[model samples]
Target: MVIISTENYEKIVEFCSKFKGLTIHCERQLHKKFSDIDSQVLSAILSKEWQKHIKQRHHIILKSSRIYLQEYKAQARLKGDPFILLQIAIRENFSPVSLCRILLSVEFEGKPKSVTNEMIRNPHQIPDPLLAANVLNCLLNDKSDGPITDLKRQTIGEDYEIRLKKLASDAGLNFHDEVYLRRKGYDKTPDLKLAVPCMFRGKIINWIESKASFGDMASHQQYIKDQLLSYGNRFGSGIIIYWFGYLDQIGRCPENKDCIIVTDDFPKKDELVLINNPFGPLLSSNISNITNLL
Candidate 1:
């Protein structure tokens, strides 16, 4: 549950920036390079910093397509990472379905177009050949406008959310997770909303949010605008867990108003105040009726 301060966080981010463009396979190299940081923490920081670079690079790619296209194609040929090509294609003019069709055609040296074209939108099964996997992975991965990076990050985020829910459950906490709350028509729901609010460390905690990435300055501010503020207004004070750690300075952001406590992990049993008296199923049914502060 380490809470990194502002100054240390900036230094960590700066150190991690050197690893931009490094792929997932570079974990071992990163571990040797970043001896001072935990492997998991280093990975998260590198992910944030690399993503920033990728975003900026993508913008430049769009603006200077004539120059970047040649560079991208060369990189794609040198490395099996076709995402470079896929991303540029998407950024250029192709919608996802169109991109799939184009890549499958003989123009791109793909399998018979008819065979692969049917499965444009995956999860809606079509006769997809095993041969199509590489291209499909690139096309799907490029949907987020990056090359093979975000899919891994998305998986990590889901894994952390599962871990958070498990820890909360093991501690005898009862709550409706984000999916359940969403189905019930709640807007701006946090990862876990306690069925019954509990006092923890002298503050009432109504909800909890899990962030799989490090909380850098920009990302934290964006979350405040898109999520934290709404969660605060609707659900009252809650906790935000930046699993890798966040800028210490973000906690003091004026908009935060001390309502959100940032932490690196789920609170321990000792840190949390479990309700001695269980409210049971009726509590859930009761809370479901309230429009705010649930």
Candidate 2:
């Protein structure tokens, strides 16, 4: 975890509160006075504060909606903060991108936090609230258009689909692309679906979800709630391809009955390791088991 000095934390909160909606160049400020404070520390503090805000908002939502504690807790555990999910629960006709913009606009009261002409003039300066807000919003709402795209660029699984397609081709597996799955009356949809000829005597259709990050516990939990669990429930079985390895600190995948985690060492170009499934398999140039989830 990233650690921030108490003094710096207090300073940041105090400075930010003074101009609630103005975007201040926190990076430059830190560089000027708190030269020891790094990006990781700043990110952690911002994320923690954002999570606190979301939790507070969630309580407000529960009180207003009169939702039971048990139900709220269960839902929150699965789908992140209740306040964010509440928008979807009500069937609000807003896209993730629009919803992000709307939430930031309303939450920040349409004003930017403490940004100055000089900071704007300097391209290297990073705005604190704006950066924090964008990161928080992106974390909560995966479909939001945010800075993750810019930061990740082609590095964070942007070409995952292409790589998957190539691997499937090399394996000689018959699969479809960009398939969507939803129950007849439900609104939730899985990212991709594959027809595995070798599995279940050519009768099995497996749901596949692609994640581009080095899947840490937090990211995995979010993915489980946001995509994996729902897909597993609807489809019965699935595959999660974590291109940059599953769990940053460990090579193991979480034990799950319905899904298999595939991890790859991108830098070393080593063989892909399959985990959290019945079969302990190593995938090399022959990527056939990607279609056969045994």
Candidate 3:
């Protein structure tokens, strides 16, 4: 989880206090506009106008909010209600100025109107320190399914791969790191590739993608669409490890037969010694259900 400083919280509160009213765009409406207009044309027009708008507003944009918006759009499409996802920020006490700035930056067609005064007669307020803390927590931690930095993500991913390699070695299994698929003279690589021909009913598990953060439904879906599906197409099956156990209670992947394993579910070194048998009862008991589909 990400932590927000007291100074930053105060700044957010001060920023939000300035906006008397907020104008919001609907997700369904925005999708319609996206369908009608060419994405490149829309992006150019919005970028040109938004730069001017921000300059006139005399407000410095938050880089984190800007990055958040990029992922938020994809989440909106999945939820089928952009407003619902926006509400997460709103309820978290996101700066009205920042929210408005981000939305205006990506001005969609149709000129969607803000909610009427009847719905929100007054601007949102952060009344007390406790409330402010809650707001700050939500802003930084909620829906932080995307990485803050590519370098940091790469580091975490490498660490996970190393750990998996150790686990494979302990189990007397072969671990191939950064293995690539060669098709028609082209190369496509996955993070970690393991082939345990003698383990788990002789399954040939090809790829293992490690995610450092909580694999929420939105982020998981994006992973499936962007990376996992392509791997599945090239290689028959693979495993995805959510280190935080975010998807443990979320149940099986309804969309695919591939395995979704949470690292947290496995017993630690102090609890029980992992054996050389790859399909030992201890390990099999936890993953057999998911790997069965593989």
Q: Pick the candidate with the highest lDDT.
A: 1
The count of residue-pair clashes in candidate 1 stands at: 2
* Model 3 CA lDDT for position 105: 40
lDDT of each: 0.64, 0.43, 0.43
Q: Which candidate is the best by TM-score?
A: 1
lDDT of 2 by residue, 158-245 (tens): 4777777676556445455553333434465544555542232122336556665444455667677777777677655556655534
lDDT measured at residue 91 in model 2 versus the true structure, 0 to 100: 38
| Model 1 lDDT per residue over 7-80, tens place | 65666566555532233434456667657767777667665665575555545444554454456546656775
Question: How well does candidate 2 match the true structure in TM-score terms?
Answer: 0.38
Q: Which stretches of candidate 2 lie over 4 Å from their true place?
A: 1-156, 179-191, 197-205, 248-255, 265-294
Number of colliding residue pairs in each model: 2, 8, 0
lDDT of 2 at 173: 52
Q: Looking at candidate 1, what is the lDDT of residue 166?
A: 97
TM-score: model 1 vs. ground truth: 0.67
Candidate 2 at residue 197, lDDT?
26
Q: Summarize candidate 3's per-residue lDDT along 1-294 as a digit string, tens digits.
A: 122233532332343334222212222233344454333222222322333344554343445555555555565556545243345455534433345334434433233344211111212333333323333333343221112223455786677777876765665555456644343343555565554322232334556677655454546677777777777777556566665433333335576555433233222434332324553565565454335433
Ten contiguous residues with the weakest lDDT in model 3? 115-124
